[model samples]
Target: MLISMNTCSEISVVDCKETAEKLNNAKRYSTIIIVGRIAIEYIGRAVSYAPEGDRIVLLKPDGSLLVHESSKVEPLNWQPPKSISLFSCIENRLKVKSYRTNPHEELLIDFIKVDFIKICNIVTSKLLIMGKESDIVKLIVLNPSSILNASIVVGTDISTPYGKIDILLKDEKENLIIVEVKNEKAGISAILQLKRYLEYYASRGLSVRGVIVAPSLTDEAMAMIIREGIVYIGIDQLINGIKDIYRDIYSYTKFKT
Candidate 1:
């Protein structure tokens, strides 16, 4: 005679291990283990067969494989202080050809695409310079909020005692940031125009902070700024400063996480 016992609780450790091993080996399907509860059931994945050339890959936390497709990425290339260089990084993933001859030019191109205004502001602070006037205008349009948020205001074709001011800004402290922007080298006329704006503001009992923005500055123009204690800005420096700010913010958040 034989007796049979049937109970769910009767399974031993050896039996559980054997069952698990069998299940794992049943098929070659990849396994993804979840620790604790999460909002999403599965994370996305991208796998690449080869590591050469341009490609995009989505990945899960674990090493387990998932779906993968091949696609080209763009290459970023440019000269230093160009301000549009940030696009090169994205371009690299797209397999785009780059013709930049030096690292600085390449970096400038990338910086422009990443954040033009910040680059412009930094240029102003550093007094380096920009190669083109259109580049400055493009930077302004790319980040209109920066101009809008300024302590001063800018009006188009505004009548001023010192010719027409391209842009004007007034702060809460009754301080004015007078601006004159040109697409080419700011000549002697640019300086004279700025002086008129300064005198206009001073006549109104407002302290003025003179700013001269041009695609490029002549030696005479730069010397004038130094002698008069006015501020001269270009595009690249602004972009670099913006990048630094972002890097700092990212570092802080990463540390907290």
Candidate 2:
């Protein structure tokens, strides 16, 4: 359908069901222009007719016509008329709907144009942090036998001589599973950190099975863990463990699939 704004002398083509479906599926658009018509029922009116097309011609306030298609239209050999208003009435309709639906969203979107980079940076940072944390949790959930064994108890913020341990698992018999997580690299200090956790828990009358988890670990750090008798677990291992738990809990083979 073609919607024209009297104030801005601009026109916009409304999308039809078929066109919207195509866009939804492949999410691709070509520059081809198509024109047709459709019947519409107005809220308070009996019936209405509208142009059903992929292209529309917009009349600028200056009396110049610009051809628009599904993508964009370049003004070809057209001189703009000076008397036309710069703003289009069609945009006012969109603004009205936007404000009615979500004024804050509209305001933020409008302001985003001015602070695009800043807004993008903030959004990206938040998404990255959330994604990292989610990945870490998913990893821990993978091995139910490791996480939920009757003897296992996962503890957070356990104090140690070296630093605060993020998570520590202990069996019912008080055998400790020292876990130290670093979202990024398992640094030089990670091995030592786990050692400290093991020692601290052991001193508290708990035997330890040391485990270190990180996105990646340095060769030196890995060697240190092996030398120090620590088991190293990556995020993917944890995710697998979680999947096993979900399978057991729901009694569904689909999870295993």
Candidate 3:
């Protein structure tokens, strides 16, 4: 989707201060663009099936542009357009123009209601920080004897062909224990995920036990757990049971020191 200033209609004189303020408030997730007329007059058409849904991507300070459709995940329609530049024509009135080589197609953005100019700061730590899940994994990894009596956490987030196992531990008898941690209720899919990890370990000559750790387990999930011979540890049970063990261990270590 291209916008040419030549065929575009003049809406209003652009306000520099208002434009800066509007651009400053840009977000990371999704952006809305209004094309053709000024922002106020063509709100309905721009937001609807008109040319407003085109996503504008700012290239470098040198002025390269990437325009794509919003409906699909992949931008399969992007062709390398050359000599792209943004010009402030007549006060606040702005225009973007680009050219494609060989066939020589000129792409122009005559009028733009919304355009993202600067990079917006996006916080990514929230996505990686799984509160409940991380807490449970930490407790199990730090103090495995609390969950797997006479066991110790050997590794965590262990990778296999099937998928990654949340926690890996070893029991007193030297058998490998694979744990799958879920913050919410253990569902059928969770049981299946653990089962796949178990199969990967079982194929080897190693002795492995599969376990699911969650707040609760559905009846169907529990049935699968029992059939698959996988252990289910409730979050509440672990907290109540493990805290006492941790306290005793801490006290003992403190006394030794």
Candidate 4:
């Protein structure tokens, strides 16, 4: 192995076995990047294979793995954070395998000829995202019961002569549901929109539930929903979800300084 003399981060040239040993110590480095000629194999949820080629591999202390090709901005293959990472020297080559238990999926990266490596611990503030109603609705659509007492999400952005329905759901009691989502506080106009959708369905001789989801409701909006019989859902979960994202950014790798 040829190590750079001036800095600890760069490895000018690498020996596979030696590099694998350093990478095996996850606590020592928050991030590791490898530039090499390698091949990849992923098995578990589905099978995938990438033949030997020059590529970049990134390993996170949280046990995530990302392999990138020469061109794309996104990784060609990735394993989510907090998976189990295992590295070894096999037949004079470095092999990295990361797997998660719940999903029972594994990603294998074989470094045929490692050219360069960057190993260092990193510290930074967690990411904060500005989400819109569409973002929360996406999460809710996948897990309908979490937000609504719905058994299934029938559809989203459903079309009607009135404004498009944000979400369409079927409840446990099998009632069709029409949902309108607001990223901010609910107002009288929001209540009126819900009422119009509900009335439209009622005119068609269909019985459906109307719901408006928002962080807060104005006094008049609350009164209007009560009179119109529209259910109002507070968006506490969406607020908490942002906090959770910030916390989970570096859950596995704690910074000392």
The candidate 4 region of ten consecutive residues with least summed lDDT is 1-10
lDDT of candidate 2 at residue 26, scale 0 to 100 = 23
- Winner on TM-score between 2 and 3 is 3
Q: Which residue pairs show collisions in model 3? A: 3-108, 3-109, 3-110, 4-108, 5-110
Ranking by TM-score: 3, 4, 2, 1
lDDT of 3 by residue, 140-215 (tens): 8777886678898888878798887889999999999998999998899999999888888888878999888898
Which of 1 and 2 is the better model by lDDT? Answer: 2
TM-score of every model? 0.41, 0.45, 0.47, 0.46
* Clashes per candidate, residues 3 or more apart or on different chains: 49, 11, 5, 0
Number of the top candidate by lDDT? 4
On a 0 to 1 TM-score scale, where does candidate 1 land against the true structure?
0.41
Off by over 4 Å in 2: 1-151, 203-205, 252-257
Q: For residues 60-156, could you state the per-residue lDDT of candidate 4 as single tens digits?
A: 7777788988787889999998888888988878888889988899898888888888876666576634378887788667657655543588899
TM-score of 2: 0.45
Task: Let me know the TM-score candidate 3 reaches against the reference structure.
Answer: 0.47
How would you encode candidate 1's per-residue C-alpha lDDT over 161-236 as one tens digit per residue?
5577666666667566776778767877788788878888788887888877765688888888888887776545
Q: Scored by CA lDDT, what does every candidate get?
A: 0.44, 0.46, 0.62, 0.79
Candidate 1's C-alpha runs over 4 A off are 1-156, 245-257
lDDT of 2 by residue, 14-77 (tens): 4233333332232121111213221111121122323333333332322332434456357321
- Worst lDDT run of 10 residues, candidate 3, spans 39-48
* Inter-residue clash pairs, candidate 4: none
